[model samples]
Target: MEQGSHLLFWKAVNTVILIAILYYLLKKPISRFISDGINSVVSRFEKIKQEKEEALNLLKEAERKSQEAKEEAEKIIKYSQELAEKEKQQIIAEAKIAAERVIKMADEEIEKEIYKAKEELKKFAAKKAVELAEEKLKVAIDVESNKKLIESSLQKL
Candidate 1:
């Protein structure tokens, strides 16, 4: 029993001395390795953060461009609608003018036809009056009487 206790005490002292020696020998290299690992991890985290920011900027730019395109499309649609309305008004005006011109031409033609008919009626009346006067004269006077009347009218002239 005495020998076992002495042996146990010596083993405990040996284990403590061995731990102290290994710690002293490996401390600087272990600290350096741990610090390098921490620096690498920190740099990786910064790179990921920068890449996330860039992706967010790209997304914002895309959204802005999309908004601009939508605005431009709306403007184009409005312009087209206005242009079509203008063309429709112009066509209607032209049609009205053409209809007015046709009406004026028809009125003029009717006036001309009415004037020709009036002239023809006047000529017919004049011819009919002359024929009636000749018939009355023939019934009222003989050939001899017509010669005497002609000589009398000539003397008066």
Candidate 2:
């Protein structure tokens, strides 16, 4: 009975040592590998998140640029329209001024021509009156009646 008890005690001691060795060699190494893998996966996820954020910021910038371009185009169009309207008004004003100047010049020329014609008519009428008075004097005077011409011309004319 004493011999059997010693053998049983030795066996129990050996079983405890095997369990300690397995825990140190296999269980601890497996736990370390699983922890490293989990950390690697978390780091990859963080990298993807940063990339997504960068892409979103780029998209927002593009949209802002598009809106600015549209505003610039609108401003250019408005400026062109304003310039065209101003040109049209200026052209109309110039044409009206030119027409008025032409009409005024024509009226002045007509007045000058009329005044010149009146002066010529007056001179012609005075010359014709003198010629007609001489013709009437010759007809009233006779060749042998010089002494009595004044009394005869006064009665005949």
Candidate 3:
């Protein structure tokens, strides 16, 4: 029993010495590895945070640009409508002017045609009167008197 107890005591002392030696030898490397792992994790978290910020900024910019585009589209539509209205008015005005000019020309043409008709009627009436006078004169004049008048006019010539 004394020999077994002595042997156990020696074994316990050896185990303690071995543990101490190993701890002293490996402590710095283990600590450095743990700290490096923690730093790497922290760096990854920071990178994620920065990416989130950049994404938010990009989203805001996109929203702003979308609003600007909407406003510009409205402006363009309004300008186009205004231009169309102006053109429509101008076309209508031009049509009215053309219609008035055509009416005026038609009136002038009608007056000219009326004047021509009146002149033709007057000429016809004068011709008819002259024919009637000739008929009357032929009936009134005697054949012997007409012969004497013609003979006298020839002597004067």
Best by lDDT: 3
Tens digits of per-residue lDDT, candidate 3, 1-157, equal 9999999999999999999998999889989999999999999999999999999999999999999999999999999999999999999999999999999999999999999999999999999999999999988888998999999999999
- For residues 68-151, write the lDDT of model 2, one tens digit per residue: 999999999999999999999999999989998998998898889888888888888888887888787777666756658777
- Clash statistics: count for each candidate: 0, 0, 0
Residues 54-120 of candidate 1 have per-residue lDDT tens digits of 9999999999999999999999999999999999999999999999999999999999999999999
Model 3, runs deviating above 4 Å? 1-19, 128-157
TM-score of each: 0.58, 0.50, 0.69
Winning candidate number (TM-score): 3
Ranking by TM-score: 3, 1, 2
- Steric clash count of candidate 2: 0
TM-score of 1: 0.58
| CA lDDT for candidate 3 | 0.97
- Answer with 2 or 3, whichever has the higher lDDT: 3
Stretches > 4 Å off in candidate 2: 1-45, 121-151, 154-157
lDDT-wise, the better of 1 and 3 is 3
